[model samples]
Target chain A: MASMANQGAPERRPGIPGTPGGQPRGRGLSMRTRQLFWVWGFLALPVLFYGVIRFYPTLNAFWLSLTDWDLMSEPEFIGIDNYTRMFSDPEFWKVFRNTFTYLIVGTPISLVLSFLIAFALDRIRFGHTFLRALYFLPYITTASAMAWVWRWFYQPAPIGFINDLLGRVGIPQMAFLNSTTWALPSIMVTAIWAGLGFQIIIFMAGLRAIPTTYYEAARIDGLGEASILRRITLPLLKPTTVFLVVFSSIGFLRIFDQVYNMTTNDPGGPLGSTKPLVLMIYQTAFSSYEMGYAAAQTVVLFTILLCVSLLQLWLLRER
Target chain B: MRTQILMAGLLAGTSLVAGTAAQAVEIEYWQYVYETRVTAMDQLIDAFEAANPDITVKQVTFPYADYQTRVVAANMARKGPDVLQMFYGWTDQFVGGKVIQPLSPEVFPHDEIEAEFFPIVTAMKRGDDYYGLPTAVRSLALFYNKDLMTKAGLDPENPPKTLDEMVAAAKAMTEMDAGGNLSTAGMTLDMGGQDHQWWREVLVRQFGGEPYSADYSQVTYNDAAGAAALKFYTDLQLVEKVGQRGFMDEGQAAFRAGRAGLTIDGTFRLGSFSSIEDFEWGVTELPANAEGVRSNYASYFANGIGIGAEGEELAAAEKFLAYISSPEAMKIWLDVVGELPARRDVALTEENLADPIYAPFLKGLDYAKTTLFIDEAAQRQNAIDMANRILIDGQSVEESLAQAAEAEQAIIDKAK
Candidate 1:
């Protein structure tokens, strides 16, 4: 995607200066340039839209962080006050830890499960398209409703779906969402469930993109399926792996909706055990009406994401 | 031919735009009442529209929980309603920043009925400036299962007179199964998060301590009286074991189901629990801790019309306000809505106060008080945290009160 953007940049035409033959070629070249200009103009609308709508807000957020601005009052410039308060605020630290836990626990579980499903689906010969769509159904639903459904599913009593299932098997009912010790893990489990469908589809595309000739060539060498997968398939899927890992990590870092909606009994309920960084920022900004502090927290979140993305790129680069 | 075709298309497009353009002055009113009073709102809007002939009133109904956050967001986005329905706790914050316009008591002409409202209604007005008119009132009261008290060898007619007697009766009334596990509880000590702030405030006042002082100027919850209040509330669940510890809504559900002895709630819940046919229930004053300190917290909301902060549609908005607040209009509003009226003359009606279900609330309103603190959300949230800590975490009363006072004072300091 990045390379495609570079290719679209306009370059000056060469090989035409002062010769009589060059004049005819230059006229033809000018006609093509006019055509190219229209194409570029069409593409510029979306590019400019993304720059203004997405990038400008992010830049404004950074500037807003340095000032104490209620949406109503004139902003008073206060350097680092919000950041300093955030450092000392116990609630921020709790939410940060919760978000990190979701990342560490949720990302790997999703990655492994998705890859396994992708590998199996790729090997199946019958109804592969139907099965792929079935597996991908969850990712297509806008997430809030799905998150709410998961919340009811994780209710802290025997009435909860999972608890009822466990109960029918003669196991004791569990307080999945109510107990502080289990709340984050319970939320993470539902998150991984909501998350796995998308990752599987991404990995399946990566698997299908690899040509069968490489596998055929390996089969003739008497290599087993496991050996072929380990040696051939894994080596060729580096770009997809990089994409999934980076995207999944960012998703985990900003896991707000599941935690926010699922545990509403306390607002930041269940002893604030399931509150994430994004939720904390939202509450501070809107509920507490502290826009400056929320802006500062947004900056911190941005820094964390930027650092994580850069680190992943460095770590997963081709050797 | 091409010019004729283009001219035909232009004429049609211009007519379509002109036909669809709106003509009336649009004002939005956001509220929490639904199902119970939507018919009343529609009627009120109909009457207002008929009276004004120029203004259009649009009613936006949201679930009760979503109102504050939605209003705040819309206001920040510069798309807020011209008029809003505000809870008792929200009035101070709205008035503090001058985000809302004040209706002059002089300009408001409903045959000059200012003297007809309770003194508590005047609390809605900040010195020399009134933001809006009072629309409805709610007060907390003690709701008890009469059959259970009788079955436990207690007099069904005699309710507890003081806080100490209330605890003893609860201890005596609590029932357990053979396994010694708690099968039924006597009372719950305001166990829920956030919503229990009103209960905590009433407890503070019952002990002769105010959460904030009378002038709404100072927070006084961490003092000796505050500690006594906290200890009394926590002791019901922790030390006495007469009430359940952590399960708030679950326990309240149980009480509603006739499995518990007592629950403290507001007058609004009468409509919800009116269908319970198994157990005979009755309402009485929420027990006071100190004798002669009969104060209880009032929970009411103000719904009135206001001009947009841009100050454009004052005449149309004021006309609508006047139309809705008339005595005949208030009757239609209250009967369909089930909210107790804010006007003293309307509330004193034989039809409203005559209901036996309203007995406890009317008694509670005798000493009823509204929290006068600014930064109402912060004060409410801190009080909730303090109550939860005392009941669930078993913290000392002094510690809980100290933490609550500190949290609230910080919010107060921030505004300054």
Candidate 2:
């Protein structure tokens, strides 16, 4: 083992070509050039992959958004007619509002619930790992499966668990996932629940990273638990909060699977009340075969994501 | 080394010669993955291969939801099927996208196809060319649970024959829990499913309205007749309170679970419904309105030769298409997939007409209308949204019908 380790160490050593303190084999290349060659050689695969797969398609979408391509005929240059049409389309505005509703209602509820659970979990010693794992189960489960289960829960009496429970307790049956007013919120609740596990795990990690000495110092100063949480804990957890806010905000904005699966028959349905922008884009592209219009919708989504993320980063800057 | 090289060359030469001696053409066939349809196709392929031993056919399937997208993507990649099955409603999109080539006149004679196949098969026609053919066609019918009807004190043998009778039966069969939540829905009201078709093709015409103009270029279901049709549908839930939407999450689910007294579904449901253990269900023609005006909706999935096929593959696909639409293959499709044979003679045979399960759907073909949908999904969603407006948003029937008409007209105009 010792001899093997010794052999591996010298070979891995940077910029020293063959043998320890040996003369350079040739004056053909400098140390920096050789180092850069190795660096780029390793990065070449990923760089090429992103260039072809990600960057090319992204640029193509921008060009496509300006044209009218129906995936059959040649794309005709339309000079922002798609943008004009999208702005005037009432469906697009409904989807826009729905997407914002998911972001606004879903993010804070998930974050606060996760933080509260994580904070309490971090302070406990008994079966902490098991409870954390329990909370994290939904995170690892497939979103479609989770959405279907929630869909079953939202069914009417004799089939739906929630409605059955309500009936048992003498409460009127709620028309969840059926009522236009309730469908979005019902789906939002599932999205929030599906996302809670990941957020909780992240919050726990952030909680663990906080120095225990600060708490000890606060205890010595006879600080209340709430004050210690507000003054020391929250302010210290700012970085994690900012990251989660941006991450989850992006997630909520681009929500699709739960909404699609829960309303499989009529996705974004109950009069398009539950439709997010992504689903609308999907329907436009695949269902209607309006590729250019879908591309325009994609451009709008990308812009929204950019602005929202930037706003969050600016708002949560280290001040 | 010299000896080994000589031996390798000799082997390669012999194999190349052997390959040229007996050439076999292989073609790929693509369809949506329905269990019975796939099974029936496999059986037909086996029979076809036995007769034409030189041609090999491969079957590929995608889920129904993703079938069109997959086919389009595959065609774009130059790896699409030689023969493809497509919904009759998608003929326009498929033709526009060049997913399929028009059937050659020499192989599929236009006169023979028009005469032998049902008139509804003409939906595949564009311009002067026919692009596809179907082995089987489907039409809607009333599916009733016998047990539920008997329990409701209605005669199980005699299902509803008139619109008023159907509503009365639905009201009688409906059972509510102590909490006033529906325990058993008298009828399934799924606007997203076959209900949209029922409303557009059946109810609208029965209520004295033409859903579309003769050329199918304009929407005409926004008048008083259309509003009355829309009102009757919504009244099943709002006023009559015979059923609830999303009761068992889906209309088919409620019917299958024996929690629904009646459901309006296509003949494609026959195989699934027949498989239910110990369940007694019956099929009947959709109820006629006052003055005995009867209307129904007919649809089918047709097989087409993909644009990707060329030379030997094209010949093979043409042969396979002919074989699948032949009388023998249509019979197998009827037995296995439970869809009515596309050929009028094949479907209207005494044996098929005598079968209680298929008779109602077969009879429906006489009065059924095949909607020339340019964009079936979008147009169906318009109907669904129109229903939601009345049922969910409490919008007036006239307003909802007008909105639906406008939306449908826009779809038609865009397609044009």
TM-scores, in order shown?
0.81, 0.95
C-alpha-based local distance difference test score of model 1? 0.73
| lDDT value, candidate 2, whole model | 0.91
Docking class of 1: incorrect
Q: What is the interface RMSD of each candidate, in Å?
A: 4.6, 1.3
* lDDT, residue A262, candidate 2: 96
Lowest lDDT 10-residue stretch of candidate 1 chain B: B190-199
- As a TM-score, model 1 comes out at 0.81
lDDT of each residue in B95-121, candidate 1, tens digit only: 654456778566764245457665676
Top DockQ: which candidate number? 2
lDDT, candidate 1, A1-319, per-residue tens: 4334325423423433544354333344454564565567678999899899999999999989999876655568999999999999997898888888888888888998999999999889899889988878877776778877877676433235776566556566566666667878888887887888889989989998999999899999899988998999998998999999999999999998777777554555555778888988887777666788899999999999999899999999989
Clashing pairs in 1: none
How far does residue A169 in candidate 2 sit from its true spot (Å)?
A: 1.9
